[model samples]
Target: MDDRGGAPAPPEKISAVPVRHPGRWVAAAVLLVLAAMLVHSLLTNPNWKWAVVGQYLFAPRVLHGMLLTIELTALAMAIGIVGGVIVAVMRLSPNPIVSGIAWLYAWFFRGTPVLVQVIFWSFIAALYPYLSLGIPFGTEFVYFDSNKLVPIFVGVVLGFGLNEVAYMSEIVRAGILSVDRGQTEAAEALGMTRTKIMRRIILPQAMRVIIPPTGNETISMLKTTSLAAVVAVGELFTTVQLIYGSNYQQIPLLVVASLWYLVLTSVLSVFQYYIERHYARGTVPLRARGFRFGRAQGGLS
Candidate 1:
């Protein structure tokens, strides 16, 4: 009811306008120009030798080398994951000696360059020509020649695996530490053993933190296996080197290796995405959790 005994007049309409971002337009134009230039250079440069890349991309020897690379990656990561978990638990041990030894292992492996470690393992026979298994300081029951025991492939795997163990230990330790102390105490209150608490309560919750870095390490291991080329381990890079060494088609062969690595890493990345999504259930909205890989609902396309 209005004071004049009539309905009040409707409020006047107000208009609104969207904001403009001129800087975004400028940035987009610059990026487009750079991309066009790069594409033109790649297409016009006669030296890329795309035909040779195509020719040797699926060659028998190349495929064999790729298979070896995959094997090395899988084995190394398996060793790293298992060894890392053990070392991580050792690092958290109450005994000073155990913790100190674990710390020293991580320090030594992480402080040195991986290439140096690989080379050292490759030539370790020079340090100790024989290895024995028996009592620590008593009669030996079995002996093995170092040269036979640690071949180039085994040496390379040990190098990659041990070095990765150091890195993954720290990663696992961080994940374990990320879990709340209250949870462990609560588990203790419920009469759970320490091992049970860790296995059933802490680790499951900690996996969300552990998984992303572990996935990254796996992908990194895929690329780092190329280092085996230095020791003539016949991996992808080594195979490519042998091919290009004879034909002098170094650039194309390298491009082939790079393409294969990109493809493998891309596949690993997709797996990582799904693994992260699985562990992220109940914490984040599904649509906003990771890359959608689908139609955009709104915002920047």
Candidate 2:
């Protein structure tokens, strides 16, 4: 017998059976029917012009366009990532001025439409004919023609990257907030500087929260590259648009572009899954095993 008490009362018995969900099967059946209808329509539709889709998919111009889209996405995402980190840190600053500046930047960029921003950058020369690097109210050290320095490709990249920076900053700020505040206090107790604390203690933990959304943003950015067509930059969608414009087979050309975008996104999704898995150490591992076909252990052991 224990000194203060005897054995505790037996725990209450509860049934472990899961709730039946027959409506789920009904919903799945309805969804399958809808999907079948969609597939049927696509297959039977003559205007799709599958032959044309097949013909231009491998065209040299199309391939070059896709390469440029890839480049734009990569460069823009890089800027967003690095700038987001700086802005997020600023957002977390104790000083109101620093945080206010960050807020202003995030607010203005995010509030405006990305297309407007793109057009603005494309014609920035109208606002500032020359970009000068010099001491304020002192010597002008360098000057470059805005029109030359900010061409179509440069404008598009700057547009995508700047827009991404605002969104990414919020993503990063949320990630930073997800971390336990106690960790910061603990690092401080250990005499860690703010920079070291962030580098070693905070950012690593925040990455788990940050990565999933970043993957989503990357996929969105891939699609958003289509907007570059407005600026005369020859990204994938632009190439498809030009082909269709020339041949007047708009549907099929668009379909080819959609197929290529699908392929690229699928590849990026696989990469994102592996990256998530890598960072998921010590947490419950995600189901990395994709669907496998052709095998089943049938006999009862």
Candidate 3:
């Protein structure tokens, strides 16, 4: 025992207890074998028409459509996020009427089918042929066909972006709510304006919560752009449809689109992981704790 003032120290630590889980090893081997078999089967399958997939993977028409899809996704997400934040803020307003209006907007958008909205907008000329700009009842400075004003692309954007605003508003609202009430109170006590508090204090912290879901929504928005096909917007899937229609090779063409979507989503997922890590600086990261990378000590084999 060391001759200090306190009781004798305990014996020096001998070793960590054995962390045994034989079942895990067995499960890993089984999963590996199954994965190998699956890969082998996929490679050997003759009907998959992998050559066709490779041929169309980077086809010109497909690339054009991909560009359109990307454009639509970017526009939709940009507008949706901006509109969503506005709606989320309005939903949190102290005024009952403001909050009620925001609630109704969210409810209607969320409740309706997005496809219906797209089709409705696409044929809006039938509903209201002329959309006049000027005072509502006094003056008509200009007028244009509803369909011409809200063309197929604009219609698709309205459908997707408007619907997305509802969902994204909820996501933003939830993130904002996740911030401690004390923070808002403290900011108020400091005589900060509501806008300033939201911008500088609350929103920055809320972003740690907001970004992951927003990333997910962005990826989802990418896929959701496919729905614009029904509105005759020439997006990636729609381009694939046009190609397959001509050649009558629907499955192979679809496989091509699938590959592109998978690649894009995979890239986005990696981006999201880094973004999440960036926000999670002060917190213990789950990835770092999941698996130890260095060489292990002697095992009880």
RMSD of each: 4.8, 7.6, 6.4
- Tens digit per residue, CA lDDT, model 2, 1-301: 4566997777889979998999999999999999999999889999888888888999999999999989999999998999999999999999999999999999999999999998898889999999999999999999999999998788888998999999999999999999999999999999999999999999999989999999999999999999988987899999999888989999998888999999999999999998987777767523333323443734321
What is candidate 3's lDDT per residue for 82-137, written digit by digit as tens?
A: 99999999999999999999999999999999888878877878889898889877
The local distance difference test score of each candidate is 0.94, 0.91, 0.89
Candidates 2 and 3, the one with greater lDDT: 2
Q: Of the candidates shown, which would achieve the greatest TM-score relative to the real structure?
A: 1
- Where does the lowest 10-residue lDDT sum fall in candidate 2? 285-294
* Candidate 3 stretches greater than 4 Å from native: 1-26, 284-301
User: How many residue pairs clash per model?
Assistant: 0, 0, 0
- Residues 218-254 of candidate 1 have per-residue lDDT tens digits of 9999999999989999999999999999999999999
Off by over 4 Å in 2: 1-26, 285-301
Clashing pairs in 3: none
Model 3, residue 55: displacement in angstroms?
A: 1.2
Q: Measured by TM-score, how close is model 2 to the native structure?
A: 0.85
Q: Which pairs in model 2 have colliding backbones?
A: none
- Of the candidates shown, which would achieve the greatest lDDT relative to the real structure? 1
Off by over 4 Å in 1: 1-11, 286-301
